[model samples]
Target: MKVDASAGGSSQERSAAKASDPTSADAADDAGAKPRAALQDELEKLDERLKKLYEPIEKIFEEKLKPGLAKLPTQAQIDAARAREGEAARAREAEPSRADLQPSRTTAQP
Candidate 1:
């Protein structure tokens, strides 16, 4: 935007003017930034507090639950087993079941 020197010419020269301009959206953002920064600082403090609170619980889980988790089959192992079973299951689906293959006992008269 071209402006006369009386209206503050360059962008760098207009920084103070824009900050003070209540009609400008930049002014509202500038006004809101201080509180947003304060809120960000407060949230960081709360996060640190929660991190301290959960530290012991996380350690206990790592010690206790982790051993049990290690004993369980890995996801890859589980997936391989499922894949093997899937082939068998598909074959079973294609073939008639044992009951369907058996002869019916009812004798019919012609």
Candidate 2:
């Protein structure tokens, strides 16, 4: 088998060219980087705009809703509500009805 030196030398030259061609690699890097940078810049601009737009609305909600919500039922009010429920239950039991209070036979047993 005859080995071709010229063919082998050309392959070595190709490898050296690939290794040394920084401009081509840098161009490729730049091509990939440009769109990513553009997207990042757009996202940052959108985030800043969103923050600016929401700030006043957030402040308004905090100022308006918080105070009104604070005025609603504390723990004491909740205990009073439970007490009222118990009183209502006792009143219903004590009250008399014209109709029979017994469950019908057609209903399923508990």
Candidate 3:
């Protein structure tokens, strides 16, 4: 907040100044719009800059990520792999290995 200088400045002097100039009211109204117009232009420029920042990320997702995602395995293939691994584990658990039947004794010679 500012204290307007009262020295040599009064309402009577201000009213007389406004009375002498008819266009001052219109100029005041235009002064208000100048800041709004400048603010609107600044907002538009910021919007354009923000959109430019996202363009490269959007392009990368479309060109690189989408194709790599398509090449990945489907749900059905992943489930089938589960069954194959479970069957191999069962076979290994049920059978005794030939290496287990032939015992080898090795002595480390230091």
Give lDDT per model, in order: 0.87, 0.80, 0.83
Per candidate, the number of residue pairs that clash is 0, 0, 0
TM-scores of the models, in the order given? 0.42, 0.46, 0.38
Alpha-carbon deviation at 98 in model 1, angstroms: 27
- In the range 30-109, model 3's lDDT, one tens digit per residue, is 56588889999999999999999999999999999999999999999999999999999999999998988886767676
lDDT over C-alpha atoms for residue 99 of model 1: 88
| Local lDDT at 85 for model 1 | 100
Of 2 and 3, the candidate ahead on TM-score is 2
Order the candidates by TM-score, highest first. 2, 1, 3
In terms of lDDT, model 2 sits at: 0.80
Which digits, one per residue and each the tens of the lDDT, describe model 2 over residues 53-95?
A: 9999989889998888898999999999999999999998888
Q: What's model 1's lDDT at 70?
A: 90
Score residue 34 of candidate 2 by CA lDDT: 83
Arranged by lDDT with the best first, the candidates are 1, 3, 2
The prediction achieving the highest TM-score against the true structure is 2
